[model samples]
Target: MTVAVEFIVNQLKQVLLEEQVSTNETVRQLHGKDESHHALSLPDIVVFPRSTADVSAILKIAHVERVPVVPFGVGSSLEGNAIPIAHGISIDFSEMNAILEIRPDDLLVKVQPGVTRSQLNKELKKHGLQFTVDPGADATLGGMAATNASGTTAVRYGVMRDQVRDLEVVLSDGSVIHTGNLAAKSSSGYHLNGLFVGSEGTLGCFTELTLQVYGIPEFVTAGRAIFGTVADAVSAVTALLQAGIAIGRVELVDEDSIQQANIYNETAFAEKPTLFLEFHGNEAGMQEDIAFTEAIFEDFNCLSVEFEQDNAARNKLWEARHSLAYAYIHAYPGKKLMSTDVCVPISKLAETISYAREQLDIAELAGGIVGHVGDGNFHALLMLNPNDPQEQAKADHFNEQIVQYALLRGGTCTGEHGVGIGKMKYQSTEHGAALAAMKSIKTALDPYNIMNPGKIFT
Candidate 1:
C-alpha cells in the first residue's frame, strides 16, 4: 500500500472498530464495482460506518490526508456510481441499515443510508403505506436518491427526487447539514434537496434521508397488451396519456425482450411487442380506466389484451417485467450487460423508440428495448463480450448514437442512471454552460475532491 493510504487507514482504525476497517482483498473487491459493465477498480480499504458521527470521522481523516472517499450502499448502481475508481477508501453503509422513523400520519419516513427499498416497504405495509419509487432492484434509498432513480411507478408516483424530503449529509470537511425539512412544500432557501439527490455522491455523503410515502391504492389491476410493432405500442401510450387516463404503470417491451423473458421465466407469452400495464383507484374507477385502456389499445391495432385482477397473478405479471434485465444476463453467459436509457418528450417517444430499434438493428448487437413508456423513458439492454475490443467499440458507438439522438430531441443522455463514469463524456453536451456552474459548486463544497472523485464531471 502507498504510505499515504496506509497512514489514512491507520488513522481511520483509531476512530472505528478494527473489524469495521478492512483491507481484506475480498472485502475491497466487493466494494469496488457496481452492477455496471464498467471495469472493476478496487479501493485500498473498505470501512463500515454505523452512524453519522462515524461518517464524519472518516471524512475528516480523508479530507485532511487528501484521500479519496466513495460512499457505497448495496452496489446496485447501473453506471458504476459506487465504484471507487481512484482506489482510496470505500465507506460501505451496510452496517447503518436502519429505519430511523416512520410518521405515517405525515406521510414521511426517516431512514439511514443503508436501508433498501424493499426492506422499508415491508415495514410500511403494516401502516397501509408504500414508498413509490420502484427501480426494479431492491436498491438502497441512499443510492437511489444519489441517482434520482425511477421505474415503472414513476409515471404515477414520481421519481426518487420527488420522494426525498430531506437529507442529512456530511461534507468533505467533516461538517454535517440537512438539505431540507419535513414540510410538504416550501419556497424557502435553495433547492438543496434537488441538488443533493442527483449529485451522485460528488458533493457530499448522505447519512440519513427523510422521504415521502403514499398509502396503498384502494384497488389495483395489472394487464398486458400485445401489438404488431413497437411503434404501435408506443403510440398507444401517447394516446392514453393525451386522453387523461390515470395509469399506475405502463411499460413497453419489444419482441426480443419478450422472447428472452419467455425462455428465462418459462412463460408462454407471445413473442411480440407488448405493453405491460397497471391501474390504481377505487374498484369502480379502476374498472372504468381498464375499459378505457383496452379500447385505446384496440384502436392502436393491439392484437390482444389480458388483465390479471388476482393479487398473485398481478404480482407474477409485474415480476416478469422487473426480471427482464436478469433474463438478458442469464441468456448471455459470457457477456456483460450494458444498459443505457434516455428520456424524450411524450410526443417524440414513438419516433425516438423507432430510431433506437433501427440503430440497434444496424449495429448488429445482441440487445433488447424496454421502457417505462408512460413517462417517455426507455432502456436498451445490450450484451457485449467485455474481452472483445471490437464488440465493445460497437456497443460504445451504439450508445453514443442513442444519446445524441435524445439530446437533439430535447431529452437527457441519461434518464435515471446518474452521470457515473459511463455517462461522464456526455455531460458537457447535455448541460453545456450549466456544467460550469456545477463544477463551481463541487469545488466550493468539496475543495479537496475527496468525495467520489472522477464522477459526474470527467
Candidate 2:
C-alpha cells in the first residue's frame, strides 16, 4: 500500500469503532469486485460507517490525505461501480443499514444508504407498503442511488432516482447537505437531487435517503406471451407500451434464454421468445388492463399468451425472470458473463433488438437476450471464456458494436447500470459535449477524486 493509503487506514483504525474499521478483515477477495466484467482490485482498508458522522469523519481524513474512498454496499453492481480501483479506503455501509422511518400515509420512507432493497421491502411490508425499484439483484439502496438503477418495475414506477425524494450527502470536504425536501414535487433551482442520483459516487457519499413508496395493490396479475421470433416479441412490447397500458412489468426473454433458464432453474418454460408480463391495480381494472394487453399482443402476432392466476404461479413467473442472469452464470461455470445494456425509445425498440439479434447471429456466439422491454431497454448476456484471449476479444467486439449502434440511434450506452469502468469508454459518445459538464461536476464535488475513482467519467 502507498504511504497515503496506509496513513488513511491507520487513521480509520484509530477513530472508527471496532466493528467499523479493519484493514486485515477488509482486504478480502469479495470486496474487490462487483457483478461486472471488470478485473478485481482490492482496497488497502475497508471502513464501515454507521452514520453520517462516521462517513464525514472518514471523508475528511481521506480528503486531506488524497486517498481514494469507495462507498460499497451489497456489491451487486453490473459496471464495476463498487470496485476500489485506486486502492485506498473501501467504505462498506452494511453496518449503517437501518430503516429509520416509514410514513404509511404519504407512502415514503427514510432509510440509511446501506439498506438493501429486500431488507427495506421487508420493513415496508408491515405498513402494506413497498419500494418499487427492483433491479433483480439484492443491491444496496446507496449503490442503487449512486448508479440510479432501474429494473422491470421501472417501466411503470420509475427508477431509483424517481423513487428518491431526498438525499443526505457528504461532500469531499466532509460537509453534509440534503439535496431535496419532502414535498412531492419541486420547481427549485439547480435540481441537485437529479444531479447526484446517478453520479456513481463521484459527487458525494450518500448518508441517508428518503424515498417514495407505494401501498400494496389490491390485486396483482401475471402473464406470459410467446412469439414466433424475438422480433415479434419486441414488436409486441413496443405496441403495448404505445397503447398506454398501465403495465407493472413487461420483460422479454429469447428462446436461448428460456433454454438456459430451464437448464439452470430446473423448470420447464416453453423454449421460445416470450414476454413475461405483470399488472397491478384493483381486480376489475387489472383484468381490463390485461385484456387490452392480450389483444395488443395478439395484434402483434403473438403465438400464445398464458396467465398465472395463483400467487405461487405469479411468484414463479417473476422468479424466472429475475433468475435470468444467474441462469446464464450457471450455464458457464468456468466462464464469465458479459452483459451489455442499451435502451432506445419505444419506437426504435423493435429495430434495435432486431439489429442486436442479427449481430449475435453473425458472430455465432451463444448468448441470450432479455430485458424490461416496456421501457425499451434490453441486455444481451454474452457468456465467454475470459481466459481465452480470442473469446474475450470477440465478446468485447460484440459489446462495442451494440453500444455503438445504440449511440448512433440516439440511445444511451447504459440505461440502468451506471457508467462504471465497463461503460466509461462510451461516455463521450453517449453524452457528447455534456460529458465535459459531468466531468466538471465530478471535479467540483470531488477535487481529490478519492470517492470511487476510475468510475463513470474516470
Candidate 3:
C-alpha cells in the first residue's frame, strides 16, 4: 500500500529547513483555525516555507497534486481568513520572518511575509520611523495586507492597502512577480495591488512586501472625553472630525467596556461612555488642536475631558484601548467572542451605532461596542456561549440584524475583517452584480480553487 502525496512531501521536507511537510494530526491542528468565532478544521498537511522559492515550489507541487493550499500567519485573524477548511496543505510563513531592507532615504521598508507589525516597528524605532496600522494584535504584515486590516490609527494613516507600495507575490503556477513599484502612486497595469491587498490569499501568496512608513512625530498628547451617553461620545468624534483636527487616534469605547478594562487591566478608569483621543504635531500646533477639540467636545455635551501629556501616560491610555476585546474575554469565562464591524458615512454613524446598541439589548448579549469612530466605523462584540445552542442563536440573530441594517444604509458588512465564511452570506446583498465580477477574477486567478477554498465565496 502507498500514500499518494506523502512520499513527495517527505522528499520536499528533507531539504527545507523549517518545512513541517508532515501529515501529523498535531501539525494539522496547529494551522487549522485563527482567533475568530468560526469552528476549526484541520488540514491534512502543514508546510513552513522559508523563502519565495520555497513557497513557489510548494504551490507548484500542490497544484499538480490537486491539494489545496492555505497561508497561515500568527493565527491572530479576527475573521476565519487563516482557517484551512479544504484539508490539504497548510503553508505557515513564520519561518520567513525577516526585514529584507530598510530604505530610510525613501521612507519605505521591504520585508518578508512572516514579519509581524510590532517586530517591524521595534526595528524601525532606531531609524525614527513607524508603521501605523495597529490592529490590536501584533499580526504578521502579510496577514494584515491579506485582510486589508486597519485599526484606531487607520482613521488618520489609512489601512494596510494604503501603506503597501509594492508586493512580491508567488502565483499558483510558481511564477514570481511584482505588483507595483516604489513610486508614491502608480496608474500602471491592472491595479494588481488593489486586487491582492484584500484578496485573503485566494489569488497568490505574498513573499515580499514594500510598505510606506512615517517618521515619529515631534509631540504627542492623549486624552479621554467622557460622556453621559454613547450618542454624546459619538457626536464629539463627528464634530472633531468636521472641525478638521489633526488627530492621530480617535477610539469610541463604551462605559461597559471601560468597566471591563478596569477589571481586566487592573487600572482605574471611570465607567462612562468615553472617547480615547490623541493628537500628533509640534507642541504649539498640538496645543491649538487640543483646544479646538475640547471646545467641540464641550459643544457636544461632553461631561468631562482630561489630557495626559507625558509619553508614559499616553502609552497607558492607548494600551487600555487596545485591550478592549481581551477585556470581554476575561470578564466572561467559557464564552466565545464574536465581533461585527460596519463602516458608514460620517453622517450615518450615530444612527448606525444607536441601532446596534438596541440589537445588543434586544438579544440580551453581554458585550461592548468600540472601534475607530473617527472613520465612522464601529464594531459590536458579543460574548457568546459556543456550546449553548440557544445563546449561539441569539448572537447569530444579533449579527444578522446588525449587518442587514448596515447593508440597507449603504454600509459594508465588514469594514476590515475581510469576507471570510462569516461575512460570505452578505456578499450577494452587498455587492449584487459586482459579486459576479469578483467571482470571475477568483476563477481566472485560481481555476482549481486550491487556494483558500470555501472562503469569501465558494
Candidate 4:
C-alpha cells in the first residue's frame, strides 16, 4: 500500500505542488464521504486541482496508472454521489472556485466548477441578475450540476441542467473538451451539456461552466397557504398551475414537517399542511396572480393565506421549508437522514403525496413529506437509526413503496438527485434498456471505468 502511495505521490507532485496533494488521514477521510448514511470509503489521497490544466494533468496520470478518480465539491450531495468507493484519488475542486466572467448583455455567467450557487447569486445580484437554481445547500455549482439539483424556485426557473449553457470537461483520457457552445439554444450535436450535467462525475470532471442567469423581477411575492389536508394543499397547487398563475416557487410542507420546524426554529406556523407560494412579476400582474391564487385556494378548502410583502419577511417565511432537513437531523440526533425523492406527473401529485404519507404511517417510519410540489417532486425525509438493521429496513421499505408508486404513475426514481450510489438499485428497474445505453456511453467516454466508479451502476 505504501509502495503504491510512494509512486503516485511522486508523480502527482511533479504536476501539482507537494502541498496540494495530501495523504493525511484526516484529509483522506474528509474527502471520502458525503452527508449520507452510506458506509464511508477513504480515498488513498486527495488532490486539490486549481485549474482545468491541473485537472487534465491529474486525470492523465490517474488514467495511465489505472487509478479511479472522484471529483468532489462541498460533499453536499444527499445520495452517495461524491463518495470514493474505490478509494483511488479524490480531486477536490474547492480551490478552483471562481466567477470567471459575467456577461450581462447575454444574461450568461462563466464560472469554475467549485463556485457555490449562493456565491454566484451574490455576485449576480450586484448586476440585478440571479442564478436561478437553488439546491438550498449553498452547494458547489459543479456538484449541483452533477446531481441536476433543484429547489423551491425550480417550479419556474428550472433545474441545474436547464441553466447550463456550456461545460469545459477533462475526459478520462486526459483530453479536454467543450461539451457545449455558448449559444442560447442549440440544435447542434449530441447536447453533451445535458449528458454531462447529471453524470455525477462518471463521465468527466467539469472544469469551467457557463450558465444562464435571470434579471431580478420587479415584484416578488412570497406566502404560505394553510390547507385542511395535504391533498387539499397539493390540489390547490395543481389548480393554480392549470390556471396559468405564472407562479415562481411553490412548495409543500406537511403538518408533521411543520411541527419539526416549529420545534427546531422556535417559530409558530399553523400545524396544518401548507403550500408556500411565490410569484414573480410586475406589481399589477402579481396582484392579479395573488387574487387568482386566493380564489383557487378557497376552492381547495384552504384555511388561510398569508403573503410576505418584503424580502426579509419572504426569507423568514421560507425558513421553515428550508430548515426541514436540519430540523429532522436535530430532532433525531445520531440518526442519519435518508431522504427519498420521487416525482410523478402533475395529474397524480395529490395521490402520490397522500400515498407516501399513508405508507410512512403504516410502516411506522420516522419521516415527513415535504417537496417542491409544483414540480410534482417531493422527498420523504426518513431518519434511520444507524445501528438498527430493522429500523433501516423500515426506512428502505418506505422508500421502495414510494418509488414503486411513482413508477407506476409514470414517474422516475429520482427527480434531481441523479443516479448516485444510493439510487443505483433503481436504475435497471427504472430505465431497463436505456440503462444499457447509458452504460455504453459511460464506456465510450471513460473506457477505463475509473471516473467515480461504483456510482450510477452497481
lDDT of 3 at 154: 88
Task: Look at candidate 4 and tell me the lDDT of residue 170.
Answer: 95
Worst 10 residues of 4 by lDDT: 417-426
Model 1 CA lDDT for position 91:
91
lDDT by residue for model 3 (53-101), tens: 8899888887777778899899998779989877787888999899999
Which parts of model 3 are misplaced by more than 4 Å?
A: 5-8, 14-19
lDDT of 2 at 124: 91
Q: Candidate 4: where are CA atoms >4 Å away?
A: none
- For each candidate, what TM-score against the reference? 0.99, 0.97, 0.97, 0.99
Model 4 vs. true fold: TM? 0.99
Instruction: Give the C-alpha miss distance for residue 85 in model 4, angstroms.
Output: 0.6
Candidate 4 per-residue C-alpha lDDT over 25-113 given as tens digits, one digit per residue, 9 for 90 to 100: 99998987898778899999899998899999999999999999999999988888999999999999999999999999999999999
lDDT of each: 0.93, 0.87, 0.88, 0.91
RMSD of 2: 1.3
Clashes of 4: 0
